[model samples]
Target: MHCYFHLVHTHERILDETGIEVSDLEAAHYQALKAIQELKQEGEVDDVDWHGWQLEVVDEAGRVLLSIPLDAAQH
Candidate 1:
């Protein structure tokens, strides 16, 4: 069985509004969500962001397939 991992960065708005600091693991999940959205839109692979957070795509074997840096340009 092949397991896919999606990593995502937490949105600044969400962090500020909630007044919660996301842990490293949670942040990855957030980035994954963003990556999935990008994949859906572009029908391919892409990375976004580069500040304090970023997104990473991985496989079941725990290998990073892609890394996307979250940047302001995306917004």
Candidate 2:
């Protein structure tokens, strides 16, 4: 399955052009976890909530399947 990972930040919104590939819906959760980690690294901060950021995982049809909030990722 192909999923779109869009970054919904407090100041900006980023749309992912190339989606990610996963075996199934369950695998998409793992990918979302990894993507959040990368985002944290890019921000040079372990806690992304300071900037009020979140990752929205959407299906091919544009339906949001899940939202990974930076604050939640800290836990």
Candidate 3:
């Protein structure tokens, strides 16, 4: 089985305070993960986050296939 890792951080206090729908978050997370996997297979530099979420896709061998830093535009 393949697994994907995500690190999410929000500087906006409102976001932290707001209640997030678990099902929606889960669906979006997996969808983004799947897109990253496809990008990895396509030989594209997978470093993109649609929202405020960082993603890291690693293979079973513990090799990082993709690493995208979210909130990059903020810098």
Where does candidate 2 stray beyond 4 Å?
46-51
Better of 1 and 3 by TM-score: 1
Off by over 4 Å in 3: 1-23, 46-75
- Candidate 1 lDDT score relative to the true structure: 0.47
Instruction: Write one digit per residue (lDDT tens) for candidate 1, span 22-51.
Output: 345456556566555665477443343345
Q: What lDDT tens digits, residue by residue, belong to model 2 across residues 5-28?
A: 998887788899899888887888
Q: What does candidate 3 score on TM?
A: 0.32
For candidate 1, the 10 contiguous residues with the lowest summed lDDT are: 13-22
List model 3 lDDT by residue over 53-73, tens digit each: 555544445454555554442
Each candidate: how many clashes?
15, 0, 0
Cα-based TM-score, every candidate: 0.35, 0.76, 0.32
Global lDDT of each candidate: 0.47, 0.80, 0.46
Alpha carbon lDDT at 46, candidate 3: 45
Better of 2 and 3 by TM-score: 2
